[model samples]
Target: MQNRPDLAVGRVRHQLKFRLAQVKRVQPLTPHLVRVTLSGDDLHDFESASFDDHIKVFFPQPGADKPAMPSAGPNGPVFADDQPRPIARDFTPRRYNREAGELDIEFALHEAGPAATWAAQAQVGQYLGIGGPRGSFTIPTGFDWHLLIGDETALPAIARRLEELPPGTRVATLIEVEDPSARIDFATQTDLYAEWRYRSESDFPGGALLLALREMYLPTGEGYVWAAGEATIMRAVRQHLCTERGVDKTRIRAASYWKRGVEAVHESIDD
Candidate 1:
C-alpha cells in the first residue's frame, strides 16, 4: 500500500487539479475487470477523499496519436476550436497514493466504446488525462450498518468504501456480474457479507439485481445504502428499499451509472 493524500482532512474540495497521467501497469483482475495503475508527476497535488469520487479520463480519437486536452481557465476547462474534442469517460478512483503519485482505476469490460476500447488496448507509457471530482458524497460513519449494491460498474466504488470503513463495521454487499469468476476478494477488515449474482446469457431481459435484493434479508437498524448500475434496475432497487424495506429516503444514496442499451448516460438520485 502507498501513502494516501491529505484529501479528506476536512470537507470535500471543490477546486481540483487536472493532470496528464501515464499508464504504469495494467492487470486483468478477473474475466471482466481490469485494474489500470497510472502515475504522473503533475498528480502530486491530486485529491479524492470520497468513496465514489469520479475522474474524467480522456481518450484519443480513432486514428490520433494523442488526446487533445482542455485547458483550465478561471471558470473551468478551456477548449480550442481548432483541436478535435477528446472523448472522455467518468470513472471512480479505486486507489490513490500521493507519495507515489499513482492512482488505480478499475474498468468494467462490459461495454464497447472509446473508453472501453482504450482500456482494452491500454499499454504501458500511454497517457490518459484526468480531471477533478468537482465534489464528493461522503457517507457518515454513524450508521449502524452499510448496504452496498450494484453491478460491475459499481465495484470500484464499493471496494473503496469497504476498505475505508472502520474495523468491525457491518456491511452487506450485493454485486451482479457475468459469472462467479468475476468475483473479487474484499481486502477490508469489516464484517462484510458479499453476494455475487451471475447472469445467464440465455436469460430473458430482466432485472436480476433487483430480484436478488428482493430475496435477501436486509439488515436491521439505521443503515446507509449505496446503489449504482443500470438506470431502470437501480430505480427498482431504490423503490424497493424505500417502499418495501422501510429504508429512509435520506439514508439511501442511489445513482444510475448507465441504462441498458443506452449510450453515454448517467443519472443520480438528485437528478
Candidate 2:
C-alpha cells in the first residue's frame, strides 16, 4: 500500500507550503462536466493527503489577464503589478500525479459561477494559478460499514473515496442528481449497497435525497457517515444521523458543497 507516508503529523506542514501551479489541459468529460489538468514546476513538492482535499483556482476573465493565486500566508506569490487579479474559486483535487507534475480537477457546468464558466471554456496551454492542498479527512476503513451521500458537486470526492477503499469493505452510497443518466459507476470490490436518488427538473436540493434517506433501510452496525451537498440538505442529513439514527458525532461528516441561490462558493457550510 505505498507505505501510507508519515501522513498523520507531517501532513499539515506539507499543506502549509502551498505551491503555485499552472493549468495545462482541459477537456469535457461529459456534457455538463469539464476535466482540467494543471501542472507546474512547483508540483514536484505537491504532497497529497487524501482524495477529498481541495485547492483554490484563480481564473482569468475573457478580456482580462490571468489572476494571481493567493498564497497560504501574508507573503506568498506576488501578482503582476499592472493587471488586476481575476476572481478565484475553491474546488476539489480529483486526482494528483506528483511524478508527472499534474493534478486533475473536475467541474460540473450547471451554473454560471466564475469557476464553472472558466472550466467550461478552459483550454490547453492556458495559464491559471492554483494554491493549497489545504487538509484531508478520512474515516477509518476498519469500520463495520460506511455511508456516502452527496450530489454532483461532491461526486469527485465520493468517487475518490470509493476508488481508494479496500476490497470486501462494506459501504452504502446514496447519490442525488437531477437525472439518472448522470450516474457514474463505482467498482469497489466491497459489500457495497448504492442507491441513486433522482431529483427531477421540477425538484431542487434537499427534496428527493431527504425523502429517500428517510425511507431507506440502514444496516445495523457501527458505521461512519459522510455526506456533502447543498448546505441545508447536508445539515438535515447530519441532524438525522446524530439525532434520529443515534450515530456518534465523530462518526459522521456532513458538508455543504454549495448553497441554494448563491454563486461561486466552494466552502462547505457557511455558518
Candidate 3:
C-alpha cells in the first residue's frame, strides 16, 4: 500500500513555499467542523517536516469588512506593529499538493476564536495569511511499533501520521470524537490496531485519553508515541507514559493542542 494516498512521496520532503492565500470552505464535516481548503502561489514552496507539523494562520481584524492580509515589513511580514496584531492560530496541514499548489486545513468552528469564526463564514476570494511550517517531525520508519492517541482535535495529525508510515508498519491508534458519525475512514495497509471512543458530554473537562491509555496493556516493544489535544490531558498521558510505564521522554512527542476555557491564540501548555 502507498504511504500517503494524498501526497506524492517526493513532495513529502520538499520545503513548502509560504505566502498568503484565499480560503474556500468545503462541506462541513460536522455541526462544529469546517474544512477550509486554501490555495495560493506561495503554497508551491510551503515546507513541512512531517504530517504533524503546523502552520500559523492569520485572520482579519474583528471589524474588518474585506479579507485584508498582513503587510510584509522590511525584515519580513509585519503583523500590526502597534496596538494588537490580527488573529493568529495554529492549524495542521492535512494535505498539500505541490502540483496544484493548494493546501487543506480543517478548522473546528467554535463560538469565540478568530480562525474558527472566519472558517465558518469564509467566502470565496477571501484572503488569509500564513507562516512557515518551519519544520516537520517524524520518527524514522525503523521502530518496531508505534502508538498514537488523541481526541478530535488531534485527528488530523494522527491520521496524517498513519498515512506516512510505510506499509506493514505496526501502529496502534485511539481517537475520541463527539459521536460515531464523526469517525472518518483512515485507509492504510499498515498493521493498524485502531479504536474509537465516544464522549457523550459536549466539551466537558476530563482526561478521557489518559483514562483509555491507563486501562490498556500495550504490546512490549521499542516504539514511539505521539499525542496531542487538551494540554491537561496530554500532561497526564505524558507523565504516565514516561514515569509509570517506563517510556522514555525522548520517545514521546506530546503537546497540548488546545486547552479548555482558553482562547486559541492565548492557549498555552507547559513544556
Model 2 / residue 185 / CA error / Å: 2.2
TM-score, every prediction: 0.91, 0.85, 0.83
* Prediction-by-prediction clash tally: 0, 0, 7
lDDT of 2 by residue, 1-271 (tens): 1223232112343445545556788777657667788898877777667665777677766675655554455555455567666576767788888789898888877866777777777877777766676566645666667899998888888887887788888888988887876777775688889889878833666688888888877777667778887878898888877788777676677787788888655554322
What lDDT would each prediction earn against the true structure? Answer: 0.82, 0.73, 0.72
The order of the candidates by TM-score, greatest first, is 1, 2, 3
Candidate 1 lDDT over residue span 1-271, tens digit each: 1122421123475675678889999999998889999998978878887887888888777786667788778888888898877788889999999888999999988657778778888889888888887778787765678899998889999999999999989899998888788989988989899887877632642256667788988777667788998888788888898889888777788898878887667688652
Q: Sort by lDDT, best first: what order?
A: 1, 2, 3
Candidate 3 lDDT by residue in tens digits, 1-271: 1243332222233333337787654657677566678887767676666877887787867776533445645555555555576677889988887887888887766667677777888777777777767556556665677899887777777777888888999999977777787787786778998877777643454445556788867777667787887777778888888888888766677887888788763233334
In candidate 2, how many clashes are counted? 0
Residue 96 alpha-carbon offset, candidate 2, angstroms: 0.9
